[model samples]
Target: MHSTRPFLRDLSDSRRKGWEDGLRDGYAEGYFRGQAKVIVERTKTSFPVRKIKVLYVSSGKGFPYSPIDEAIVETLKTLTASVITAETKEPIQKLAEKNRPDLVLALDGMDRPVEQIDAVRALGIKTAIWLTDDPYYTDMTKKIAPHYDYVFTLERNCIEVYRGLGCRNVYYLPFAAYVSHYRPTLTRSAINRKISFIGSAYWNRVEFLRPIIGGLMEKGLKINGLWWDRLPEYKQYPGGIEIGKWMGPIETSEVYSGTKIVINLHRSPFDETVNNNTAKIGALSPNPRTFEISASGTLQLVDSREDLSSFYKPGVEIETFSNSDELMEKVNYYLSHEKERQQIALRALERTFRDHTYNHRLNQLFGYIFK
Candidate 1:
C-alpha cells in the first residue's frame, strides 16, 4: 500500500508541472501573436506594400552609412514584393533601365549618381532619396534634393530648407536602430565604465568638452573616433582616446551594453569648416546614435535638441543635458545611483524596440510615399 501511494503522488506532481509549463508557453505564444497583430492592424489602412518594387541604392560608404543602408535594404525587402540593390559606385542608370522598378530609393545624398537619378525619373519611375546626414551636408544635398520625386531628411529643420529649394515631397524621417544588431546581447563587465563617447571629434565637440576633459579622464572615459587629435588637451589624457577606429553597429551595441553611461552629442550646425551646411540649418533632431544607445540598453546622456522629447520621454526614457556642466552632473549622478540609471535604460530599451527601430521608421516612410 505504501509503494502504491508513493507512485500516485509522483504522478500527480508530474502532471501539475506539465500543466504549468504548457500554460507559460501558451502565454508567450499568445503575447507574440498579439504584438504581431497590432503591427499588421496598424498598417491595414496603408498602401498595398506587396504591389511595389523598389530599387534600393547604397553609396557603400564605410563606417556609419554602409551599415545603415544595409539595414534599410533589409527592411525594404519585407515591405515590398521585390527589392533590387545597386551601389552608387556602379551605374545605377543601367540597373534602373534593366529592372524598371516601380520606385528607386537611394540612401544618403552624398556621392549621388546625379545623371542616373535624372535618368530613372525620366523613365517615369518614382525616385526618392533618404538623406542620413542632413543639414551637416546640406550644401551637397540641396543640389541633390530637387532631382528626386521624394526627399526625406533626418533633420526636422531641413524640411523647410528642402521645400524652399522646390523639393515638394520633403518629409522629416529620423534615424532608428537596426534592432536585431543593436541590443543588450552581452553582459556588463565586472567593472562598469563611468562613461563612453563613440563619434568623431568635430569642432563643436572639441570646444564643448574642453571644460570637462580633465573630469572625464578621471572618470574612466573610452573615446573612439576620428580627429580626437584635434582636441587641445588630447595629450593630457594618455591611453584614453583611440583615434580613427570606427565601431560598427554590432561592436557599438556591445560597448553600449557593457558601459553604464553613453554620451550622445549632436554635431554643431554652425561649424562650417567641419560641416557643409552653408545654409546654417540647425540640426535639431536626434541622430542615429540616439536610437542605437537606447536600444542597446544603456543610460544615454544626450544633449538637448528640439525634437528630442518627441521621440524619448525626458528624464524617464532618456536623460539629456543643455551643456557640458549639466552633462557632467548627470554622468556623476547616474554613475553612483545605479538603480535609477538602470531603470531609465530599461525603459528606453523597451521604448526603442517598440517604436524607434528600422521597421518602425520604414513603415512611416512607405506610408508617406504610397499615400
Candidate 2:
C-alpha cells in the first residue's frame, strides 16, 4: 500500500497554516471595518463624548482568542474611539504619540522594555493593563502597577494585589463571552455517549480527572480534548474519543450542543500551595472556559469555586461538583434527567445574556474609568 502517513501529516500542516493565515487576514480586515463603523456612529451622535481614544495591545498568542479581541474592537467601534493593536510596547508608544489616545489597554501586562512603559507614561495617556492570568506568577502589578493609571483584573482576587502595589484604581473585571458568537444551537444531534472537556492539560487537572475518565468509559461516556493525548490513564478507556487541542468559538459551541455533558475543570495551583503566600498572593481565578461553557447553554459540571456562586445560583443557573465522585455522580444524574438538564441550561443561558457578556463588562469598566 502507498504510504498515506506522510501525506496526511502534510495535509494537516497545510490546513493549519491556512487557518492561521485566514485568522490574521480576517483580524486585520475586521479591525479596520470595526474602526470605520465606530467613527461613523460617533459622528452622528450629539452626546458629549469624552475625548477618549483607546489602544488595545496584545501579544496575540494566547487562549480565548478572537472573541475577546473582536469584542474589544466592536466596543471601540461603537464608542467611536481609536483602537490599535501592536505586538510590542515600542510600536505602541510610537502609536500613542501619533494617536494620543486617552487610554491604553494592554491585554497582557506591559512586558515590553521598561523604557517603553516610561515613554507611554510620559505621553500623559492613561494606561490600563488587563490581567487575564494568575497575578501571583507574572507579578506584573508589582513591577509596572504604580506607573499605570488603572489595572483591570479578570478575577476579584487581583484587586487587592493591585491596590497593594499603590495603583490608584484597580477594578475587578471578569472575561465575558460574546453572546452573538457563543449561543446555543441545540438542534445539533446530541452525542449520547460523548462527554466532552475542553481546556489545556495542566498536571493537576489530569490527576483529578484520571479516575473520572475511567468511570466515564465504564458507564459508556467518551471523553475528548488535548488532555487525553497526555493521559497515561487513556489506555484504560480504549474506546474513548480524543478531539485534540482547543476548538474555536464555532466548533466549541457545536461541541457543547452535541455532547451529552460538558465538563469545566479549574486548575487549583493556588489551592495546593503549602504556604498562605499564594492565597495571600491570590486565590480563585476561574478560567474563561466557565463563562464560555455556560454561555453555550451546555449542561456544565464545573468544579466548585466561591466565584461560581457569584455568577450562578448553582443547581438553578448551573451545576457544580467538588470531587471525582461528585463529578461522576452529577454526570450520570444530568444524563438521565434530561428535563432538569434543559431547565438548568436555559437558566444558565439567561444569566449569561443578562450579566456575563462583553458589552456588560465594557459598560462597567468604562463607567469606572470615565467617572
Q: TM-scores for all candidates?
A: 0.84, 0.78
lDDT score for candidate 2 against the true structure: 0.68
How far out, in Å, is residue 111 in model 1?
1.8
For residues 1-371, write the lDDT of model 1, one tens digit per residue: 35445554666777867766777745743443344334323422233456888889886686567888888888887778999998657788788899989888888856765887898888889988999788888888888999999998989999998899899899999879887688774322333466899999998899999999899878888898999999988887768888889888888888887787999998888887878887787878998899999887778999989899999999999999998999889888987887788778877877887788787788788888887
Give lDDT tens digits, candidate 2, residues 139-244. Answer: 4446766667787887677787778778889888888777556766533344433477766666777788777677777666655566566678677666675646
Task: Give the winner by lDDT.
Answer: 1
> Using TM-score as the measure, which candidate wins?
1
Off by over 4 Å in 1: 1-49, 186-191
Candidate 2 has which clashing residue pairs, if any? Answer: 38-77
Worst 10 residues of 1 by lDDT: 39-48
Which residue pairs come into collision in candidate 1?
A: none
lDDT of each: 0.82, 0.68
Candidate 1: count of backbone clashes, pairs at least 3 residues apart or interchain: 0
